[model samples]
Target: MSDVTPDQLPALPVTFRPGRTRTVLLAAGTALFLVITLIALLLEHLSPGERISFVFTAALLAGVLFLLARPKVVADEAGVTVVNIVSRRRLEWAEILQVHLRPGDPWVFLDLSDGTSMPALGIQPGIAKRQAIADARTLRALAEERSTAGPGAARG
Candidate 1:
């Protein structure tokens, strides 16, 4: 398939915008946290001895909400990029080994050549119809291209 020029294959469509569910949850959480923090601050004004504890708790909660709501995916010609909320690692296409479309899996995954795996940017099959199938096909084609480009092409 390496011989098949890039132009021959349909361009890889960018799948998955940042997780909307997570984004919404993050927004809600932030709003709640802010309200709570403001209440805590007002209480602190009345009770100075307890202010430090309330402030610390509010800061911690805000931090967690920020991490959870952070942008997770951005796709372009270079490849898909993923950012996990807590650990915040970014992965690129060159790191991917294979893409699988399994019945039970909620989203597509990039099986790394090193035996590790990362979830695809936003290719969730559970949500749509034609789009999901088309995305899966695109991913499979990309995987085939990578395999053919790898060392095993001669044996096959």
Candidate 2:
């Protein structure tokens, strides 16, 4: 993804998700699970119950990977939805006070009207730093355009 300038915002209902990180995690997890399951099924030395247990354990590990791959930010006309590892939060345009992605931070954060900050793991600056910065600016622009109440209403 390229940098999104304030002058040319993308269409509404845009989604921001980590590009490489999510894919890598999901793929690795699936491969590992499959290898483990194959081993369990092919190893005749292990009892039937043991095979079941092994598959079950693999499934649990995959579930955890799915959790890690779950985070994303969806921005629509009305508001934005932030989905993290274990939580999902919805905020109206006005409810988002600001969007921040300072250096050294893991991901984008929304400073909410409630005085609490919420992490947006979807826009992480790990392997894709430029994309994440661009996404952060795009989200900030959206918030500012949606809720221009007063000064500092949508600072990035």
Candidate 3:
């Protein structure tokens, strides 16, 4: 195992997101929406209600794609903010007991002090395995470095 101890962590106010996935989803959603809209407009035989339904369907799909791309993790001086699909949570450094990305896991998981594990979807390994590993290491290092020395300190 490589030492996650970095020579230097990035400056504060750093943000990590699934860059490749986000880009691909956004582009695909936009393209799909446009294609559907164009077809709705060009199909002269369709009833007005059917055309409206097509556009609405396109909009709904695009919205779903946007939600899927919303997960991100932001670390600043205060703490870490984990934004998952349809939910958001802020945590103090000590709140995170450990960060793990086991083999075959979909994304990073934070074992919180409250005894609940929360998925950190921002650092997923779907299409960016290497990047996710590096990111998970960085986050682990940060949690260890920033957590105050106490009962809840993120020490192994």
Candidate 4:
């Protein structure tokens, strides 16, 4: 068990979260739920099974949309952490070899020194191209700074 409280957590200097993307997704989900519910209500003779199915479908859709809207990436002097729709990853700055956000790519990817890449879905091109690029650059800068500072400097 850890002794530190939430308030004692190290502050992340940079955090990227779904901006317009989250808003749009939430709005769309709400609109979809309303439309479906209205339609189902209008059908006065809906069978019990049909009603249950529609409710289940709406709930599932909402859950998926919520997950999709919650992606985020946080970076500090120590490292970067990415939380996506279905996964999360934490990487020390020394482990990140590069940050890639090329044209045509959907999101930023961190090339790790271990020869693997991790996608940073929070910095998605679809959110805002310029903002996404800026976030990627900021993450890259953090990685570079920490890498040059030598191992464990951030921890100290």
Candidate 5:
């Protein structure tokens, strides 16, 4: 492994991560996790079952918060995958009609050829405006290049 050069490594998918502000969620989740752990430990009077419940609830809350901070969009030669807090979606190049990142929008929206639109929360604006826009453009370019159907088919 030490002899391997960078070029020998497999191409990595381009991943767009959430802005810095999202770190607050991670910190807050950690704090909550710690606090709950402490509380559970300190509550010596509680039954074993109650203690277990407390710890479980704390873990669940922390997990949700941490997951919320993990929204991301990954793109590769094949297609794009969007991972949000509660759900994930995969779209092939031909399925995407356009990539929209207009002002006033919270995040990039993928307008699909199916006449439905899905928000790519991974490439959000606000804190990371320029990066988000660039990522959107990259997605659009990929869609245009990879789709077998001409762009005109989806423009309408």
Candidate 6:
């Protein structure tokens, strides 16, 4: 066991912002699933078993996909966590090489030491520009601070 005091660690920055694309997709998918299920239920020509199976399968698949498509971003003084619609990746502040705010880019990206880039789920294309920029700035600042502080200064 290691003796580490919480105060010795820098506080984590609040970096999460809701993803508009995800919210819109989830809403549309849910609506479609419900409408299809209702139609399958009302149509009499379809076999009872087939109708039930189709509706259940469609609803289940849509729900799962929608859940998976939800994007999330988390940042602590120690690192940043990005979870995309299909994938998730994390980078410690020390590993972050750069944070850029590209005007037309769909999302914020973190350049890593290995020359690979990871998307920041906090800024979604469909969101308001001002809000996205604000969150981006906050994330960038936190990453910069941690980077200058050096590795092992803050561990999570």
lDDT of 2 by residue, 8-51 (tens): 98888899999799998899889879999999999989999999
Candidate 1 vs candidate 5: the TM-score winner is 5
List ranges where model 5 is wrong by over 4 Å: 1-12, 19-22, 149-154
Clash list (residue pairs), candidate 4: none
Ranking by TM-score: 3, 2, 4, 5, 6, 1
How far residue 30's Cα lies from its native spot in candidate 3, in Å, is 0.4
Local accuracy of candidate 3 as per-residue lDDT tens digits, 1-156: 224655667788889899999999999899989999999999999999999999999999998999999999998877899999999999998788788988899999998889999999999999999999888888877877777753334354
lDDT of 6 by residue, 5-69 (tens): 32343356554656566677688788878888888988889999989887998788787768655
List where candidate 1 sits over 4 angstroms from the true fold. Answer: 1-15, 44-46, 88-94, 101-107, 120-156
Candidate 3 vs candidate 4: the TM-score winner is: 3
Cα lDDT of model 4 overall? 0.76
Residue-pair clashes per prediction, in order, are 1, 0, 0, 0, 0, 0
Clashing pairs in 6: none
User: Tens digit of lDDT per residue, candidate 5, span 35-128?
Assistant: 9988988988988898888889999999998888978988887788999878998888778777888889998898887899998888887687
- For candidate 1, what is the TM-score? 0.58
TM-score of 4: 0.80
lDDT, model 1: 0.58
Roughly what TM-score does model 3 have, to 2 decimal places?
0.93
Candidate 2 local accuracy as lDDT?
A: 0.88
- Candidate 4 stretches with Cα past 4 Å from truth are 1-11, 148-156
| Per-prediction TM-score | 0.58, 0.92, 0.93, 0.80, 0.77, 0.75
Give the alpha-carbon lDDT of every model.
0.58, 0.88, 0.87, 0.76, 0.77, 0.70
